[model samples]
Structures are given as C-alpha cells and as structure tokens.
Target chain A: MTESVITVEHGAVAYDDRPVLRDVSVRITPGEVVAVLGANGSGKSTLVRAILGLVPLNAGRVTLFGTPQRRFRQWWRIGYVPQRLGAGSGVPATVAEVVASGRLARRGVLRPAGGADRRAVAEALQAVGLTERAGDPVVTLSGGQQQRTLIARALAGQPELLVLDEPTAGVDSASQDAFAEALRGFVAGGRTVLLVAHELGPLAPLITRAVVVHEGTIAHDGAVPEPAGHHATPGHEHVHPHAPDESSGLWGS
Target chain B: MSLFQYDFMIRALVGALVIGLTAPALGIYLVQRRMSLIGDGVGHIALTGVGIGLLLDRSPVLMAVLVSAVAAVAIELIRERGRTPGDVALALMFYGGIAGGVMLVGLSGSRSNANLMAYLFGSLTTTSPQDLTVIVVLAVLVLGTMLVLRPALFAISHDEEYARVSGLPVRALNLLLAVTTAVTVTISMRAVGLLLVSALMVVPVATAQLFSRGFLATMLAAMGIGLVAAGSGVWLAGTIDTALGATIVILAIGIFLVVAVGAAARRALVRRRAVPAGTAAAVEPCDVVLEPAPTSPTPALDLDGPDHAAVPR
Candidate 1:
C-alpha cells in the first residue's frame, strides 16, 4: 500500500509526429532496483526521459511519488544521471566542482554552499572512488572516469530515487566495477533505482527486476531475463538480434 | 599618479575598472555555453537602440538597454525553438542591428556620424559623470546577479538537460542570461564600445583558461585579467593617444597570447623531460631482438611471385 516511487500509465511519446514510445505502462515501488532493457532504438531511453519529464509525453501520465510529473517539485528526492557523454562543456570544471553542482537541487540558488553541501560532494566522490581525481579537470579523465564523475554528481544530491540511462554502456571494466559497487551501496541504503541499458554487464546482478521495452512497449516486466546458451558464458560477446548488424555489408545482409 | 589628477581621466579609469569586473563575470557563462559572440550580437542591436535614443533625444544608454533586451529575448526564443541554428539567427540579428543603427542615425538630423563613432569605438575620455553613474549601477546589477545565481547558471551552462531535470528554471535563467548580456553590452559601450565589447568579454576568459583548471579559477583569473587590461589599457591609451576600446581589446588579446604561448612552452618542456625517462624505462625491460633463422628461406614467401605480381601489374 506504500506509494510507488515512479508510476507511468499508458504513457506515449513522439518526436516530430514520429512515435518513439507508445502504450508504455510501468510502476516502480520503493527499494527496487529496476532495469529497462532493450536493443538500440527500442525507446528505453525515451521512456526514462518521459518519466523524468525530460521529454514531453504525447499521451497518458507519469507520476513521481504519486505526484504528477509536471507538478512534482521535490526534485531533491530524485537524482538523475543522464546517458554517459562528455561531462566537460567548453569551460573547464574539476571533478569536485561538477559533482558539487548536484547539490543545487538541495541548496537553493541564492544560498551559498554550506558545510553539508561540501560533505555531500566529498562523500559522493568517495563513493565513486574518484576522491583522488577530484581536483582534475573532467576533460582530463578517461571516458570511464568521466562517467563515474557524472554518477558522483547524481549521488551528491543524496536522493531517494536514482534514475540513470546506460551507466555502463562504454565504461572500462574497472570503472564498471566501481559503478556496480556504488550502486550496491546505494541499494543497501534502501533507495530505488531505475536505469536504461542495452546489456547489463557488471550491473546484471544488482537488478532485481527488468522491464524490457520492445518497439516502445513493455515486452516483459518480471525477473531479470537470463542470457541463453552461449550468452550465459562469462565474457561472451553480447549480441542483440534487434540491433543493426554492423558486421553485415554496408548494403545490409 | 598624474593620470589620476584630471577629472575626465579619473572618470575614464573608474569606468574601465567597472567594465573590467563586469564584462568577464558575465562573459564566463557565455563562454561556457559556447556563445562567445552573443555580446557582439547584443552590442549590434544596442547600437540601433543608441540610434533611436539619438533620434528621440533621450538617454542612449537606457534606449540601448531596452532595445537590446528585447532583441536578446527574441534571440533566446529562437534558440529555444531551435528552428534556426543559433549562429545563423545571430548573424541575421547582427546585420539587421548594424543596418538599423546606420539608417536610424542618418534619420536623426542633428546627430552626426562622429557622435555615433564615440559609441562605436568608445571615447572613454569623454565619459561624463552621469555615464559613470550608469556604468557603476549596471555593473553592480550584473555582478550581484552573477554572484547570487552563479551555481544555477553554471549548472545550466554546463549541462542544460541535467539542470532542467534538477528543477532549475532553465528557460527563465536563459532569458535572464540574455538580458544580463544585453545590460553588459550597454554598460561596456561607453568604455570598450559596442563593437569591441565582445573581445573584452571573451579574451580575458580565454586567457584565464590557459592556466586555470576549474571554472571558478578561470572566472576569477579572467576577472583579474580583465581588471588589469581595463585599468592599464586606459592609462596606456592616455599615454599613447590610441583608441581606448581597441587598446583594451588588444591588451586582453596580448595577454591571452602570452599565456597561451607560455602554457604551450611549459607543456613542451615537461614532455621533453618526461619523454626520455619514459622511453628509457620502456626500453630497459621490454627490449626484444629477434634474429632471422638460417633455416627460414625463400624470403618468408617470395615477394616476386606470380600471384603477387599479377594482382596490380
């Protein structure tokens, strides 16, 4: 009977009259680690974006903690780590500075950063095992390190629910292990997590449930789907039948 | 000391000092967002405001602020819509602005091209007490807003989508940034001139970036660079009898080049010292030499074979 952390009922989304997600319904309760899985272009990203109100939904509704997405103002309660991309903009920002920005939601615009904010930033950096590189420019970090910095930024907010899109898509194995460790710590705190990923590698064991998005709708909403046959082997090459075959000739097989 | 004796010189220096502090304060965010030339675009539009004021016999600074604010809002709306690429839209505004300013100035019968030139190239020597007052007020406003909202501004400028999701008012802040940029353009028009204002806004930050590793450091260094450039540019202009705006901008650019070259040379020196050590370590333990065995004959497969010769002959 407790309120769900995230709720989407018949959610639909379109870009330029082209539908990306349709008839997508999902509900995530507190303390659940849910992974939205699908091949590329399956609209898994769009679904999460819609839930975060990053993208407009064409139809249906989304609610965070039972409050409608539009009216929901308690953003400090939710931390979002967007799809992994370069953390640095044109301007140079250190890892700690970037992570400290996450505290803006908790610390209003006018007030200065208090001791609590600094502590949160420090803790977030330590959680991601990036305390050593906290002073380095984000651009100087490796791709995986930058991704960790982003996760650290999200964690700095100390939110109850964390939403991430592909936290380990192109990360190195070491950073992936660090990320998985961080997620384990986050889950141990009895928080909730929802992420969009193509293939959960290190994160596979952390996911309690999986919601498979196929062509914009939920294909499966149950226990994590086990890899079949060869895919079950450790270090086996992960393949998606629905993904475009890059090895096929340019004209396609 | 002698330079500070004259009232006009004192006003000019004071005006430059304010411009020094404010231009780069606002410029850092603009640079972060990759909108370095936004100041120039707003400046051009403000020129049209300057023209309107000349025609109406009202305060040119006030008119410039009003007009540029509207233009800035329009530009922000266009950017938000993303229908037109931001640079293309800005180019259009730039041309439209300068064109409108020229035409309006011509229509204003009493005002001559010389009067407009003062705003164009900046005649800091002629900075009246009233102009100084306006500059200080606007500078305070710009600095105050930047100080108060820096974190939010930095958040949006760094990653707009993340900021939006974080419940920061991205749209409103963007508009405020545009307006703030407009105010900066007008405030700087009397000291650096409208046309070259962007140089002052951009170059100092560019110089600061060479040595600074973080946003706050860059911003602080840029402000310091700007202060030095502005203060010294005025004194140098007075001493050399050069155009104030050009002198200030050139000074800023000069500082940027020095720092850039210094940073590059320092990096090269570090690499030079580290390279030999790294190569020596790599060579000491991993060196492997292989000799071709006497039993391996036919040159490891015959490069002159018919199969190889037939491929492209």
Candidate 2:
C-alpha cells in the first residue's frame, strides 16, 4: 500500500472562538495530485494548514507520514508555497536567494550553501523556467513570476510532498500554463501534491482527484467534474460559469 | 589631530563605532517585522533600570539591561497572549518606563542627577576602558547570534505560519529577538543615549532599503552607512565641538534624507524616460505548476534544532 503522506482524521480547527474547519478528514497518498476546491472562507486553507501543523487542531488528530502531527519533525519532506504577502511584509530578495531558502531545512543553519544546495536551487529555477530571471529581485517580477519564484523555492527542497495555497490566484494565464508544465515534471517523479486553488485552470489535467470543501466540511471527494472546461487554452478571461453555486458565488463569474 | 590628544576622546570614538555597528545590525530584523518603535520602547524601559542602579549605587547601565530584558520578555508574553495590538503593549511599556524612571530617579537616595543625565544624553567624552570592554563583548555576542540564526530568523520574520509548518522554532526565535533588542538598546545607551539609540539602529537600515534588492546587500549597505555615520559623526562632533550623541543621530538622519530624496528624484526621471517606450519592468506574472523532482530517499525526520526543545516561557 502506498504510504499516506498526510492524514487529518476528524480534525477541527478554530480561530478565536469561531470554527473554521469541523470534522475535516483527508488522506493524501504518494503521487496523487489532489486539489482542494472551495468557496472563499469555506475552510480550505485552514484544512491544509491544519494538516501541515500550521494551525493548531482543536479536535481530532493530524499525522504526517504516519507520525503524530505534533511529533512530526521531517520538515524538509514537505515543501509549501504560501499565498502572496503584502509588498511590505518582505525584505527585498532575489529569485535565487528566496528559492535557496527552501533548502534551509535540509542543509541546516550556520553553514553556507554548498554545491548540493546550489545544484538543487539551480534545478528548481530551471524547472520553473525562471532560470534567466534568477538574479533579479523578487519584487521586480510580476505577481505570476513571484509566484513561480515561491514554487521554485518549494521545489528546491526536493520534497516528497508539495502543498500550495492559492498559487494561481491573481496570476496571468501564460504563467499559469508554464506552472502546469513544470508541475507535470514534478509529478513524474512520484511526488504527492495537495493543491488549494479556486479553479484548476491549467492544472485541471494534472489533478488525479478533487476534494471540494463547503462550509468547513468535505462536500465532495472523487473524480474531477467534467463540465468546467478548465482544460481549455489558458487565459485570464476564461470563466467558470458551470462551477457549483457556492464556489461561483465566491470566485467564479 | 588634536581630538586624539585626550584618551577620553579616543574611548568615546571607539564606543560610538561599536554601538553604531551593532544597533542596526539587529535593527534590520525589527524594521522588517514593522516593529520600528520597539527599540524606542525598550530604551525607555532601560531608563528605569538606570534609576534602580543609581538607588542601589550600582552601575546604572547594568541595572538598565536587567530591567529592559525583563520588560522585553513581558512584552513578548503580552503579545503572545494576544489581548491587544503589539504596539499597545509597547506603548504601555514605553510610557510606564519613562514615568517609572522619573519616579525612581527622584527616590534614589544619593540623587546623582549627573550620572542619570549621562545615560540620558550619553557623555561621549566620558567612556572608560571598562565601558569599552563591556560594549565590545556584548556587541560581538549580539551580532554572532544574528549571523548564526540567519535563515531561521528570516523565515519566521517573513511568515510565521509558514515557518511554523516547516518545523522552525517560532516561539524561541521570537524570544531571542526580544533578548537581542533589549541588549542592543542597552549597549547603545552609552553611545547615543537611550532617547536617540533607536535612530542609530533604524535610519541607516532604512537608507539601505531604498535601493538594495536583497537581504545581505541591504544589510551590508546599512552597516556601511552606519560606519560612515557614526565614525564621521564622532569626528565631526570633535571638530565642531557639538553634542556627541545628537550629532551622530543627526548624521544618520542626514544620510537617510540624501538617499530618500535621491531615490525619489531618480524615480521621477525614470518614469519620464521609460513611459514613452513601455520599457517598464511591470509585467503581470503567471501561474506555477509542480509536477516533478521525486525518486530520492524519503526526507530525514529529525526535527531537533538549536532551540527547538525549550519552549519560550
């Protein structure tokens, strides 16, 4: 049996006396690209965060690679790309330097980046097709390029599982198509991916399963719905008119 | 040349140089975190420590560090409790410290107002050998902590949630920042005085942020700015016979204004030149895909770190 890379059994999460996710359970096994689809404030981000131990699980349990979430220590195994932050939240960093941060867990602190670290950073940059822009400051890049820089950072760790939160949001279609192409290469290596996106878009073909989150619970879990036409040519003008009422109300046109 | 005629003058210069290097070295973290006023708050708290020292006939700076450290820890704990904004806690401490120090100074049995004033506006020409030794050792220790924990510190400062999920020790690192800020403020009190020390820490770093694109580059530029500001300010103070601490701070601010105004003028010129050609670097980005890079051994599970096991109290 393929080992489950992530498992959240009856997990519940709350923030300041308000429940965000309740009785949420999910299991991501090796090599499956599972997209968590949901409307805004439907607890999708919270679910991923709980599974990764970003938010404290108030009830039930979470386990990473079979170890209890609290005891789970192999951080390098899981690479994560968070949503874009405010422009002011960041110190100006180059694409290479920010991507190199992914290797921090593997190499440890104090020692300078070595040859292996350099090679991984180089490969990650190449994978994202940002090899040419590696020397530019991250802020100088467009939002899509900055998103690619973050993905490259996660890829630099060479993690077994990658968790991304709304990576394609506000990005241009060309960058989206490129990201999809790079993801194909990553999945070819038997890596598992837990993706949180509003619409699969360019990534529709790569998703092996879809888990829809609604109002803090798992609403649907199975094959990708056939009618969304997300597999069409990439363009920001593409709209998901057929998305369920809940998600359409939140993000779809 | 005559400035070197007095050993006291030489000592003051050394103290200013040392404090200048370390204040902004640590200040980069505070500024990135948007906790710019933290140093100011802690400096106020240290004054109470100075007052306590005067009452007990002890080294006021030593007493000030102890008080500031405790206040730093308290600020962190209050922040962790999450009752209000961090600034509220800081403002509370800032005012409480100033008020407490004033009260303590009045209550001090010996009434050594001169010593108290020395810490308020540093006696630049009064640095002793012992003071120099303490400043040097503490400065190295603070800078070393920053260097050794660079990645972890950067990670947490950038995104607390992401760092926590990555198994980085978030709480311990926060506490370490607190300790360092307290120490930085304490050591700097002797060079620029408590009131002006934060300027030494902030202005040079802010100046560097104007154009530097990466963390290390900004840090290096800030250090250079600080060195020039402090070193030149000391000599300028000696040359012109001005107040030493105030002159150093004014020099740092002067450098900031030059950079800020130059950057603004350059931006205006670039817009005029580039707008017609559509050659601006402002293109929208695209989506990212993660499809490959597997087949290696499973990542090691060891989670231990420099301060992982000990939970911050």
Specify the highest-TM-score model's number.
1
Q: What's model 2's lDDT at B104?
A: 85
lDDT of 1 by residue, A1-253 (tens): 9899999999999999999999999999999999988777778899999999989999999999999999999999998998764343677788898999999999877789999999999999999999988876787787789999999999999999999998887787899999999999999999999998877888988999998887888878998888662134233345544333455655575
For residue A31, give model 2's deviation from the true position in Å: 0.9
The alpha-carbon deviation from the true structure for residue B137 of candidate 1, after best TM-score superposition, in angstroms, is 1.3
True contacts kept of each: 0.67, 0.46
lDDT tens digits by residue: candidate 1, B146-175: 978988999999998888888988999999
Tens-place lDDT digits, model 2, residues A58-90: 999998998998888899898998987433443
On lDDT, the candidate that comes out on top is 1
lDDT of 2 at B188: 88
**Alpha carbon lDDT of each predicted model:** 0.86, 0.80
True-vs-predicted CA distance for residue A245, candidate 1, Å = 17
Q: Cα miss at A112, model 1 (Å)? A: 0.5
Model 1: residues >4 Å from true position, as ranges? Answer: A86-88, A229-253, B83-88, B279-283, B287-313
List candidate 2 stretches off by more than 4 Å.
Answer: A86-90, A228-253, B81-85, B109-112, B268-313
TM-score of each: 0.90, 0.87
